[model samples]
Target: MRVRVDDASAGQRIDNFLVRVCKGVPKSHVYRILRSGEVRVNSRRVDQTYRLQLDDEVRIPPIRLAEKAAEPVVPFGKPFDIVFEDEALLVLDKPAGLAVHGGSGVSFGVIEQLRRQRPEAKFLELVHRLDRETSGLLIVAKKRSALTVLHDMMREGKVRKRYLTLVAGRWLNPMQHVKLALHKYLTEGGERRVSVNSEGKPAHSIVRLLKRWQSYSLVEVELKTGRTHQIRVHLSHLGFPLCGDDKYGDFSLNKQLEKQGFKRMFLHAAKLAFHHPLTDQLIELEAPLPPELERHVVQVEQTEEKEYG
Candidate 1:
């Protein structure tokens, strides 16, 4: 089958376009076909990273798909809290436990639900991602032009992202800079994990102490370089693991805290600032700490006051 790329689908990577076009096809199979030169654009072979342009002719090879079971449905009634919106973008306060887009093992996620809610929306794509366990501000591009410019800004380090988190112990330094090289590896059980390695990608984070308790410290972290699991791995390596972080954290402490009703990850994406892709105006946004996390912080402060008073 062949498709002519339209404006709404322009600026998206070919692989993503194929994944969206081919219903019920596994992602690996789509990638395999692309690598094997089965997929073509304008009668020429293009790699997955090739972005589709308006009026480009894409040729898709037919594949036999197995009978798949019906997947679960996302609640169309529950829409994400929109923090900011214009013709170019949508900023959302993403809740924890929801994947950004469907893939891996998840069949549906925020993007899918958003598209379902607004079928008339021609172009919608994630600007960046947060781990499913982490919650906070997330950006979605409403236009292909917005997506392209925002992606360029990310690579140039023009976007400012900050997070709030509670660490396992009292932080001594008023400010700290962590520059760690992180390497990604698969566990024996096939689980993905990141660790600090000598030969790895360089990551930088600046952390500032916000408050201190006997057993935990609240801190704000600014990411200088974005890498998978960068914040969690860096803090864990410093012996100040994030409170309630399931991976790269203190497991025993997590279980103890869960029993005490502090069950979720303490990390939250509190702030985001970047220039508007179209207007070129600075866009600054913030999401107040979720009620649950705020309550936990108050409890810790109260306990410390009782002890020190």
Candidate 2:
């Protein structure tokens, strides 16, 4: 079957378009067809990353949809806390412990729930991703054009993302810039991990000391280059892993912190600044620290004062 791409559909990766258009089809199957040259764009075989253009024709091969029993039942729930919203975009203060989108054992995620809530909405796509354990301001595009422009802005370093985190140990420097090369690899259990290696992609982060406690420091981190797990890996390599980070952290320390009422990763996306994709107007958004994190900070300060004084 042939599908014609329109302005609303343009700029989306072909694989994503297929996944939406061919509902009930497994993502793995969609990728397989692309790799096998069964899917074509404008009568030519195109890779999955090929962005659809206006008037481009997509050729889809016959495929069987997953049986009703095979599909997971994703329940609709309460909407996320909105930090900002307009016709072109949505900024949400995503809470920690919720995956951005469903996968990797998560049956439903923020995007899925949003889609369920706004079933009448035509276009909604994640502008970027955050780890399931990290909470902060997240952007979702309401239009395909917005998504494309926002992606370009990120690539051009025009978008600014700042995060707040608590790390083990006293960070001495008022501010320090970390530039590390990171390589991604899987462990024996097929779990994804990252390490500093010469062969890895270049990652950059600027960490500023915010406050210090007896054994931990709160920091503000700015990402110059967004690589997977960049902030966590960089801090870990510096011998100051993030507090409550289950992966790449001091496990014993995590347990101790859990006993102290800090059970979740102490990383939050606090601020985001960028130009509106369609309006060309500057936009800035922030999410306040969650109550639990705020309480943890107060406790840390009180503990430090009592110990030193």
Candidate 3:
């Protein structure tokens, strides 16, 4: 198979490009072909890290995806809660338990569902990722230019993203700054994990108390540097774990919460603000808390004395 790189695909790593072009194929198999010189760019063997330039022609060997048990092509996701939209962007209020894109154990995610739903869309891609357990504002780029600019804006701190989370205990400080260096590592079983380490990327989060109960506190966390599980790690390191955070929370508490019918993490991307990548107009969007999480807050309050709001 021959694929021509266009503006939408330009600047992408060859490995990633191949993954998209060869959907349903295993990533390991894709790398196997690349390393064995079965794939070439512009008639020359290129390493997996090679970034594709505009007009580059790629040659791919024929591939057959191993069949599995009969299942639906797309996981049948409802149209996401639309936050804002234009020719250049599609902002969505993503719900918990839905991954941003497909890979690793997930058959298909929001990106695949969006593509399936809008078959006429020529270009659509996720601009940023939210954890599968996280809910709320997620940005999707409708145009490559918008994706590039949004990424640049996020890296340069030109964009603002805030999250709401409920953590245990009375977080005394009204406002606190957490600057922790975080390192990503894979577990022995190869699952992804993050932790605070001296030799790691610096992460910053400004947390403000929003509401409090005797047993829990709701805080708004603003990240200065985006990192995998930054908010969860930071709060966890501070001795306040996000309620129902299975990865870094009090596991006993999580089990108890689950028994109480409040399952899933209590983290949300509640607010986002940024300048238009193309029009230069400021865009601000807010996603209301999911009803389950709201009810969890109410449950906590009912079980304890309200301290502040």
1-309: candidate 2 lDDT, tens digit per residue: 999998679888999999989988899999999999999999999999999999999999999864686757667876789999999899999999999998888998999889989998888889999999999999999999999899999898899999999999999999999999999999999999999998999999999999987688999999999899999999999999998999999999999998987899999999999999999999988899999999999988898889886
Model 2 residue 308 CA deviation in Å: 1.3
Q: Which candidate gets the maximum lDDT versus the true structure?
A: 2
Steric overlap count per candidate: 0, 0, 0
Alpha-carbon local distance difference test for all models: 0.92, 0.92, 0.91
The residue ranges of model 1 lying beyond 4 angstroms of the native Cα positions read 1-4, 12-19, 24-67
Candidate 2 residues lying further than 4 Å off, grouped into runs, are 1-7, 11-19, 25-68
Instruction: Rank candidates, lDDT, best first.
Output: 2, 1, 3
- Candidates in order, TM-scores: namely 0.85, 0.86, 0.82
Q: Write the per-residue lDDT of candidate 1 for residues 5-123, one digit (tens) a residue.
A: 98778878999999889987899999999999999999999998999999999999989989888778867858889999998999999998888888889988889899999999988
Using TM-score as the yardstick, the better of models 2 and 3 is: 2
> Residues 1-309, candidate 3, lDDT per residue (tens digit)?
898888788878999888888877889999999999999889999899999999999999999877777765995568778989999998999989988888898889999999998988978988889999999999999888789999999899988999999998889899999999999999999989999998999999999999977778999999889999999999999899999898899999999999999889999999999999999999999999999998988888877854444
lDDT for model 2 comes to 0.92
Instruction: Show where candidate 3 strays beyond 4 Å.
Output: 1-72, 306-309
Model 1: how far residue 233 lies from native, Å:
1.1
Which is the winner by lDDT between candidate 2 and candidate 3?
2
User: Which residue pairs clash within candidate 3?
Assistant: none
Error (Å) of candidate 2 at residue 74 is: 1.9
Clash number for candidate 2: 0
69 Cα displacement, candidate 3 (Å): 9.8
